[model samples]
Target: MEKWDVVVVGAGPGGSYAAKTAAELGLKTVFFERGRRPGDKNSSGCGLGQRWWRDFPEIMEALQGLPSVRKVEMVVINLVDENNRLRYRCGTTGSDLCANRWPHGMDGISIYRRDLDPFLADLAVKAGAELRTSTLVSDVIMENGQVKGVRTEKGEPVYAQVVIAADGAMSTMARKSGIRNRWGGGCTLVPQLDFSADPDKMDDVIGNAEWVWFGALYGAYQVNFRDGFHIGAGQWLREDWDEKPTDMVKKVLQFPAFQAMCRAIDAKPREYQAHLLPWLKKPPKTYTGGMMLVGDAAGFPCPLEAEGIWHALTSGKIAAETAAWAISRGDTSERALSEYERRWKASPLGKEHEFGPEFVDLWNSTIFDPKLMARQIQLLLEFSMLHPFSVVFDWGDAHMDCFNQHLEHLLDLAPQFADFGRTYLAPLARGIWPKNVKRILLSVKPRIPVLGKLPDNTFLRLVAKLSKSLAPYLDPAVNQEAPLPREVFERSRKG
Candidate 1:
């Protein structure tokens, strides 16, 4: 039996990053991958958020050198009628908010996991983390009610002072370790197709943009890459909706917009993949005695968008830091490891996860529901197609009247939607009432002449104040300024 300081299961972003950080900190870390290679089992209609680079500048530098990555400049939300004609389209191009936020000046990088995962795993290797492939961690090694390490499928025992489970949504380590019993009902089944197309044609058609289709039961997204594109459909599954995920994929492919995009690029299907995405209302238990969980295994996927890569990388680094801290103190008990949970809760990942449910509720009521979304799209189309001369000479009273009528209709349904939102959102989150009220006021402010002209700083200040008042309710664990354990800080400095 070979003993190590840390053992990481699964070599996805979470596990690889964990291994990398721990190894770089002078810990003897081992990373395991069940597939023949790191990304063989992974699938994503991948858009790596710009925040990843903003937080990890080293990663940004590395990604810049990769041929598989594409800088995405535009993200479009589209509503297409049944006939496949574009009904409404809204998007931001260059100089978007993301470009303004990050020095890198791009929204995100679109990628293929086959290239990304392997590249990330290699980073761990270069950082001195031992890599093992074709190894399945079948169970955690436990004794006297604490995890000691893991057992491989071939019955080889690997011992470690700490184990990090990054095995994904259906994490065997999490279940077997009794940290979690089962997955929740709020899971998404995403079925996707990978296609190879002429790069010139793809560039012309996609033009550094990503497209998301609304007004469909299974919402679809199209992401362009260097040599290809990934088109996928996602459906949030509840008990009442029993359709198979593959069937949903087939149905989404029938959409006219998807068909047109494929035809335009002359795409040839290269692969079909499906994966389970966890959308927990709150993060699951991430730590126990001598063990910790990160990434999808810990249910850290973004609740609103189901984006896991950002959370995966962020949590992986945090877990490694926590593990190193506990090790330096020579304590691997559940209590010591609990700091992992505390740190993550105080990090940016925590803030995003905490607010996920509220965003989901807003999205579901305003955009996810096809009927409501269709009506809204129709209104936008009508407004855009109106003649400019009629607006200037005819005084636009008729246009105003039509708009007011539509507004009245929406207002009439507000109470019903509010009731539904309360019921639906209550279980997933708290402190939504104040946020909802603020959102409503902001939406209406644009229609008020004077208020609409007010500087952006006014609304920003109002939000800042609201956040201060609501902090306790939104996150009970708000200790962002707490000092790190003395020993951990010393060791980090030495490393």
Candidate 2:
């Protein structure tokens, strides 16, 4: 029996990052991957958030060297009617739109997992962690009610002081360890297809932009890489739903806008992949005994955007730090490992999960309805396409009357809007005051010429100091329990 300081299941972003950190700390770490190599089985709409550069400079430096990665400068939201006619289109670029929303001053990078995962795993190996590919981890070995190690399908027991489960949403280790019994109603299935085109053609067509399409049969997104595009559609699934995610993918491809985009690029389909993406209503119990879960295993994907890479990397680093601390103290007990959960909850990763259920419910009830969304998009198009000068001077009264009529139509859907406000909007607004304040400050700072030229580090330090100063008041408001909007609405109706 070979003993190691840490054993990580799955060589995805989380597992690789954990291994890298543990190994760098002089801990003997081993990461296992069932795939022939890291990322062989992974699929995503493939946007790596800018937070990675802020948190792990070394990783960002390495990623910059990859030829396949492309910086995303803009994000376009498109809405098309059932007839596949474009109803609304909006695009935003520059610091005002992207940097204010992101913690870092850049949007994100688009990269395929086939390149990213292997690169991350190699980084871990370079940091002195051992990588074992084509190895399936069947179960965690338990002794005296503590996780002792992992047993491979080949019946070999690899012992470790601590085990990090990063085996993704359908985590075998988490289920077998009894940490998670079943997925929640918010679980989504995303079917994705990768297409390759001429690099110049892709750049010309997409212009370093990502596209998100609503008012379609399903929610679809597209990311443009250096020479290819990753496109996918996502839908929340009930346990009883029989239709495959591929069917939804096909439906999305049928949209005229999607078809036109594909035709414009003359994209040749390279691959098709689907994944089970988990969106937990709340954070799950992430640690027990000598075991800690990170990434999708612990349901760390962002509820609003379903962005997994940032959460995966952040949680992986946190788990590794906690494991290292526990090892140094010679206490791998459940109580000691519980610190991982506490520390994560204090971080941004935990805060993002706070409103997960509300976001899911709101989207399912409102934005997910294609007909309602299409109507709203149609009205938005009507408003946007009108010449501003004509509206103000030539047809002022008539245009105003038309706008008021559209408003009335939208108001008729007030029940749905009310449901959203109560369930999602109000709670999110209450919880994110600190974040909103930060965004406002960031937005305002760029207008001061001297202040705008300050280095990224200086700006970040100032932001951190401001956040720390406000934590005393803001933390309580964010964490305080509040009645659900639905409950309040029901009570009001009864009254």
* Model 1 TM-score, all chains together: 0.80
After TM-score superposition, what is the CA distance of residue 472 in candidate 1 from its true location, in Å? 10
Best by TM-score: 2
Worst 10 residues of 1 by lDDT: 471-480
lDDT (tens digit, per residue) of candidate 2 on 394-433 = 4545877855765666677667657646765665553445
TM-score of each: 0.80, 0.82
Query: Ten-residue segment with the worst summed lDDT in candidate 2?
Result: 471-480
lDDT of each: 0.77, 0.78
Q: Please state the error at residue 331 of candidate 1 in Å.
A: 0.8
TM-score of candidate 2 on Cα atoms, chains taken together = 0.82
Cα displacement (Å) at residue 390, model 2: 10
Question: Which residue ranges in model 2 land beyond 4 Å of their true spot?
Answer: 95-104, 240-242, 367-423, 432-495
